[model samples]
Target chain A: MTEKKVYNVAIVGATGAVGQKIMKILEEKEFPINKLKLLSSINSAGKELVFNGKTIIVEEAKPESFEGIDIALFSAGGSVSKQLAPEAVKRGAVVVDNTSAYRMAENVPLVVPEVNNEDIQKHNGIIANPNCSTIQMVAGLKPIKDAYGLSRIIVSTYQAVSGAGVNAVNELENQSQQFLNNEELEANILPVKGDKKHYPIAFNALPQIDVFQDNGYTFEEMKMINETKKIMHDPELSVIATCVRLPFFTSHAESVYIEVDKEGVTVEDVWKELRNAEGIILEDDPSTQSYPTPLSAANKEEVFVGRVRKDLDNDKGFHLWIVSDNLLKGAAWNTVQIAQSLIKNNWLQG
Target chain B: MTEKKVYNVAIVGATGAVGQKIMKILEEKEFPINKLKLLSSINSAGKELVFNGKTIIVEEAKPESFEGIDIALFSAGGSVSKQLAPEAVKRGAVVVDNTSAYRMAENVPLVVPEVNNEDIQKHNGIIANPNCSTIQMVAGLKPIKDAYGLSRIIVSTYQAVSGAGVNAVNELENQSQQFLNNEELEANILPVKGDKKHYPIAFNALPQIDVFQDNGYTFEEMKMINETKKIMHDPELSVIATCVRLPFFTSHAESVYIEVDKEGVTVEDVWKELRNAEGIILEDDPSTQSYPTPLSAANKEEVFVGRVRKDLDNDKGFHLWIVSDNLLKGAAWNTVQIAQSLIKNNWLQG
Candidate 1:
């Protein structure tokens, strides 16, 4: 096993919905792939897909499809990751970028491989990923902001419609079968499919997700208040969000609140730091109504947290709920766990 | 105009869903009734119900069905509004109630005729009504808490499924056609059809909206934090709800946030006091993706303020969204505007 170095990946919106959930989570995490590719655009190339059990096809990406490509990922849109994520980091590839194109870029490391896997060795080769409602709300409040010390968050989300992709999940299944057949439901795409208005997410909610900013928030609420202070490095904390769009089709829930910074934090001290955190899943109890819902955290991939309490009057506030699976742990298992933490910490050359 | 005195109302859950939207908003606000009883329960009593064009008949709610009811209303469940709203207020009928039995009953007032219609002249005979997600979030934050003295109110909601009534709106339309025919959904009722589990709001998002209280919150998040501080008379304000239950069927959006104790204020000064308050309908602009959603404030009847903005780092916070029709202005147009402010302030002999 010491000789197992596999690599080559590539996905780039290969028939999206988070690029077919990053090719079914890289064939259910049997990822040490030596060559998988896929790519997309030009009308979803030829479209074949499959993965672990063979058949690839998808093609058309170009910039010489990242020559040999050692791990690309990218969920396709912010102008196709601002034109092929630096041409797949100038051919040696190492992208990860699931859209808001290089998430607040300053050397691109918005990551959430469970709250900053050491910001993946400070990635300069593009490792962004963060916003599927800020990747399950900072991966369910990064272990209650690393054992009580957060200062303020305030979220609200409840998102879904497959994070507005796959044609807003076929326009929420054709406006929920035209609102259960009473008809008239059609609305071109969603709260933000290239904005200029389009509502009716079937039963409805739409507080407008992406597209609005010039101060009034909603570029998915300033990408969950600037990718949660750039992945919790906490730029003077206090965030804000609000991003709605409900009529679900895959998890996103949220409701957050936070305030911590100690001073007797409780809810059993944020459930003992979300039961010793790590891709969290607490599912609070409220005496067995248990918790976590967006269809029981649909297609689960962790980060469920639940109705944690404490804030009848802010003894440093609390309130949680966070959920997940916005296409698996919000966007193809946090972009294949930051491409499996850049191939098991060998941090793939920037 | 001086001959306008008709009364004799009644309607206790006139066949549910906020008593059929309080009989289609008392037949579209032609409320000067004279005898429109239609009560229910005892297996939806005869169920005729047509209203303005006549038919009527629901009947069964006894204790002499509030005899010559000068104005009743109740809304059936909460042990039939704590047994026919005190026998329709010992036969004189000022009631109003729409359940959660006498909301926090300190001699009951809870009303939200645009946030405390002078607490309906200190009602001693039940006026209650407040939680259909706390009457459109304290009637869209009572004109930004009378222009900016609010303090705090978090909220979250997104509720609907007819605020959990017509069998949780037929279990969200038979679990959304058994999740659009992939089958196997069947949840009996919802986030709380008398709690103890039953998720699947078809497409999902039920952060338990009621039942679960011994301090973990949810009795619809402590009825939107003890009825928005007893209809904003402010018991040191600072509210905090989180109720959820989405996969809608008719309005109840929320998202709220607020903070306000004066200071600089401006999101156009909370949109010019939500464009001069009363029954608010601001629908914030955000360059035209305008706001207010839950299916564009479903059946309408007011409160639909929009994404008001302002909290970029808490300039006294802000961030609204609201929306109405959780059965018209959250439960039959604020219980027929507190029965038209207890019959145009004659106070209905409370």
Candidate 2:
């Protein structure tokens, strides 16, 4: 048997929701790793995490933590990624950041592997993972855009609570339990954790996702609009988005309306392209009630697309429902995929 | 003191979700009624419902039951409306129908009092109340359309389970309790209860709001499309809808995208129109994190419009967040409003 080359891997924010998912996914994928290190804030120091039957002790992340690391996956808050990602890069480690810190930076590559993996080669020692909702969306729509060309896009997301990180998930669970028990529902960590106000997500939907921008669109909406154009390399695709946080705990689902550039693409044509696309599973049999729900798509790494129908009024418009596990496909798996793509294609350089 | 004139009133399907709301609204409005007649299907016959501290038995609906009813509100079902509305009209009752039976019938006026109260004058005995989702939407959009001519509309609804009926509400409660208990959920009523498949709606969303039409659009979607055009009196205006059944038990919320004929309309312009529009409550301050969720809009008589913003890409297009108690403003209150309009305007020729 030919020996496979391995490299040293480290995970920043080792105790977070997405960070933990990254650890499990890396193990499940059995990525070629010679050594594994876990790093977090000093508050999490001495805490241990398991990877491939070995207990790895977490140390405080700093400039020295990435000295010999080949690749570091980051899922800490934006501030942590902003402070440490450059440090990691300076010490010869390529970073796949899962925060909004570097996504829109001119030199950084905001990549969804299925949509814009080639952009990874243009990175300056760091590749930014797109937002959880944006990741599955670009992946689902890229095949259609490639097959039939594209004109405009409008998306409304039914996002999961886990996208807001660990405390938000706990808030949802706690609020749900309170709601069922007829107790007072608390709202301390939702809509936007640092915003001026908080709202309960138990049995309710909030239209604001992230903080409101001066122009009235939420930051999450702007991230979707900007990142999609960047990943697709279309500066003028006329993209619009409404991001709403639902009560779901796992997967993020989107209702997408797309107007193809080509005039005569039918629903079957889109279906054919989706079925042949990688990292996509077409679940669209209306007769059999085969479509993706958050529960059905939970813990899965593939983007599930369904409800493919041509617009009743417009010949060029099509509607679709796309769903995926926000933690797996949206954050952790995509982060690991970027690392895998870099290693396999020999595109990593620091 | 001069005596006020009182008319005999009847409520068809008096035990139904919408009908119960109508009964309560009539009492709250202090409608001038000499006698109240409650009618329902034989399945619910002999059920005594209290209104204004008086018990009224729900009799099986018969054609002769409308003998002296000056204004009859019908919400039983489409077939029941088709059979009984005309008979009520023959017996000198002006029917404000809450079903889809006579909605598209020629000479039958579809009225959302805030949108087109004048349409009630053209009614030949039966004035059709628009669909629940459609009523709230048109009521919310009418002011904007009146101030700036509307060219196109596309709406996606986050509709509640109660819009399906009372049994769907029970299913949601039962399924939610079952979900909380870690037991398997049973879904017998949702997303068109008579359909072959029964998917749980406890913590999930079902995209199929009604049975699928041959054109791939659900009937509920078609209703919103057709009813919007009809109530707005603009057959040439393009309208499209995607209705999804959510887990909430009360209000139906909509994300509406509109393209206007007039250009340069700002978010402030839309807000000004909504603030002054009748039957619409503007709840749109991002600073305060104010917007209508289903829970916030439940049991309210007015439609709530918020999150108003101009589309970033389309200059003439705008987005709106509209919510309302589907049973109140969407059905019962609208029905009572139509009856009030008839009485005030002397439009009930029958």
Candidate 3:
């Protein structure tokens, strides 16, 4: 066979934490690329990023920046994606957006390559990357859904501050120091930066992760509710989420309670499926005191799940502990994986 | 009411974080103490502790040290309590043990004053303070349990590092700085110091809190499980615990799912009982985004409960979020409160 032609790639918001992770993943994956364009906000533009030993200048992201690019990875803020994602799509580039912009959109396909790669073929130019929390939950639940059929899911997330943004990461650091020194703590970031009050996260747990929606659920909670149904393609699946931001910086831990449709599914059966599933590393041996911790999964790409047990009274009910790096499996790496899937399936040529 | 005779009180583990807090609480509550005696291990003995504008020399703890003491608050360590609590009791001192030594003993009354103050009178010689996670959970559930009988509880705790000991608190501070400086993290104190391996807790979550038991629960988890039954005085009550140590230094937050014996108990009813309950702050307003956070409750003595909601499909199922400073309501404050209750009820004899 003749050598495959390399495609041009553009990274939106290349200066951001998730954007930088996307760039690193692309290089590590050795994605086929003829031209690599790095784009960022006006404030971050003109900065040079060295990727794969090549110096690339980050230009201001705009509608014109996507010209002649085959794939655009968007990890910028939601507002930036909302403004330029459609423009990039109009310029004949397929967009893998890492924000919550088009995740619930009717036309955009929210794809997790391992769970819903078939959905990518139906995307109308823009593919939405599921929320970091939602992605890991679905990644772990997809195999169970296929085998036993899920009826209800209730998830309470122990999310990291990095999910809010890079500034939040900095806020956690400063507040931690103030707490240790017995100095006055000044909180400016956690439990929704735009919210009226800020609380110190250094020695605390905040039940709210994002701004509250009209439905009494935070935006992050709503994201998990809506995205779970969309990713599973089951509009009738019952899902509820309570998202909390802990002082953790990277990985997100979730206490997930699920009710499977089929009866007689034991904990061992679920463990067998999860252990054999792709992109899942089952770190669940309670006997030997083995389970996934956010610390152990901080830099890892695989979703680690443990603490699997059947609900005491309900035969069909089960509880699972899921943990993964919110930045990796939840955002940047998933975006890059979608791009890889698109190329492997020849869906980008449309 | 002949001038309400003040008793002499001694506090062991005077150099620990819980000891410091106990001193503060004793001062704030204006405990009827004619003399405040501070004691510690030989290593920390001779250190001066300031309380109520006076510095007291911390003497080495021994059976002879409690000769004239009326009440002794012991939080040194389980081993120390196992060795010295009985000795102090034999010397005519009523001991409030904060360690796990006498918590589950048939004769040692485990008391959370707000939940079971009447049980304090049954103490043989020593009273046991419940686990921090268990204290908050029982405090929040006591009012509900009084109003509506309880059936089962499943709790997943997001605990702070201070519960592990002062060294864990210092480790969290140092590791947090290392994370901010982009340096490799060092671990020595988390997930039980005596465990074979240690993990970083700066920006991470550890699934194991205390050491593991044969039944797959950590010792901390078992404490929550066993202490809940003892404190609630319902040994038949089913409880499961998954204790996790987050990077936080003070407050412990728990996601508690409970099945009430009575059906159709609305969230409003639960809120009503909690709002009017003693030593509990009901913070369940979901409209103004008002809820209890660990930061707000860190230094406060009250147990904060919020996010009260009924499970969607189960009429008897309810979920509540509980937060409290483990060092305070969980240990030191609880011990002090027990001592006060004993005196108030004439259970202490000098």
Candidate 4:
């Protein structure tokens, strides 16, 4: 019989929304862990969090925080990851970064385990998690693409406030109550927190997700466009994204239109592939009024796909609704799965 | 100065959501009404409503109610329009229907004043108003289509609860409050009041907007697809839609992707055309984070368009976000505008 191995695991930004979910998911998954360290910024330091019945105090993350850590999961801001990721890597800790800091880096492998788990072997001490919207989308599309080759994608996202963090979720709650009471909605954080402008996200849809790039696409839209190609290893693919932030607290629902390369692909053919794929649930039955909604998908780890229909005009075109919990599968669950893959594949050494 | 001719006008379904908005718009526009009549179902017949400082008693609509009426606006329901519209037309009254009863009727002209006002002249005593979601989309696209010929359209709508009328709006409000209070949401009206199943719309996205058709498309989705082609006077235009009911109470927003037949169309070209168009407001500015949201577009009559971008890959493809009040420009204002156009163009004799 082979002996089981457990390694020390560390979670950066442990007090943040995604970081907190990471703690819960790690405990729930019963990950093999010899030790666990919770680290955050100076403001969130000293916060106590329970993991697997043990209370751990979040320590201020520094370069030495990774000295004894075998794996580090980062979900802090991009700048924090930019500053601390290499420092942790220098201390011999493999990182599965959940920020956009190192996603497009030439050496780093941007991955969604369901789509491209083998990419973990190419990691140079850092495996990048794609954007929340991109992760669910690619996870849903990977199955269809495998059955019939994919050429183009156009998606419009109905994203939740939780994707922005815990503060944004609180802002939505406060603004919604204020709206119901006929009080003026106070907008402190939304659309983009660090951006110059702020908009109330309660009972409204904000077309902007991240900061706008020079090309007129928001950073979130560009991430979906670029990271999708990188993760799918298809540089020639045509992808476009419109990322909008809605007032929901959890889960993102996307309306995706794709053009497969092959001809004679019916809805059933696509459904067959999706049903056979891992980490995907097909909930489409028009007769029964069955489909996945954001509320139904909240807290779920697998991506829920529904509203599958072949386009009336184009033989290659198909539309799908893809949904999942932004905190779980989109970030925390995906990050933890990469670490598990790393350990199982014996690819922890970069 | 020419003395404006006043006519006897009747408003059917005066107590409903769109009906109430119609009253407000009629009073605000001062539609040169010599005598105004309010009519509704027998259940709401005795209710009192005020219009322009005049208290009016609602009367039950019957076959003979339109005896001397020069114009009648119908918004009660499809069954009411199906039964009362032809009777109203038979009694020397021109009917502007805000229901789906005659939208696709071969002889009926489904009209949006900005896009196809001339279709009003072709009306045979009945002018059908386009769907709320369709009205905003076509109004925003009319200019772009005229400038660079339109070939195909793909749209995903974030529609408000009010589009389904007052009951659905109340469902959203009650569900929202219940959700906030940690109580179970009782959803009796949503997605479609007539559909078999009901789902809560508070803080959630319902992919099904209306009852599903056998083709895997909802009735709302089919409305957008079929109405766009009919109003554009192009039978060969490729159109596809996915309609979703969101939690908001006022406006309908659409993320539209279109392919122009003409090549070399730039973002500025599209913006210029939208700015010059009569019913569209161009609010696209990436640097200032300027774009129209549902809350911002509510209660306005014109269609607000923003986030216009040429597709990154397809030269002829463009993406736009279109928004407007589902009641104002979508229903009440557009219906009133058709009546006004009939009076102006002297087409009431049809």
Strongest candidate by TM-score: 4
Fnat scores for every prediction: 0.90, 0.48, 0.48, 0.83
Q: iRMS of each prediction in angstroms?
A: 8.4, 1.4, 2.4, 0.5
lDDT of 2 by residue, A222-268 (tens): 99999999999999888888888887678888888889989888989
| Two-chain complex of model 3, DockQ on C-alpha atoms against the true structure | 0.43
Candidates, ranked, DockQ? 4, 2, 3, 1
Tell me the docking grade of candidate 3: acceptable
lDDT of 4 by residue, A307-328 (tens): 9999999999999999999999
Q: Over 4 Å off in model 3, which ranges?
A: A42-47, A64-67, A147-149, A177-183, A260-268, A285-289, A309-318, B34-37, B45-57, B64-69, B261-266, B286-289, B310-316
Span of ten consecutive residues with least summed lDDT in model 4 chain B: B163-172
Q: Mind giving the per-residue lDDT tens digits that candidate 4 earns over B199-303? A: 889999999988889899998999999999999999899999998888898999999999999999899999999999998889999999999999999888889
Q: lDDT tens string, model 3, B137-164?
A: 9998999999999998878888888888
Judge candidate 1 against the unseen true structure and give its global Cα lDDT, from 0 to 1. Answer: 0.82
lDDT per residue for candidate 1 within A13-36, as digits (tens), equals 788777887788788888889898
RMSD of 2: 1.4
Best by lDDT: 4
On DockQ, who's better, 1 or 3?
3
**Number of the candidate with higher TM-score, 1 or 4:** 4
lDDT, candidate 1, at B318: 80
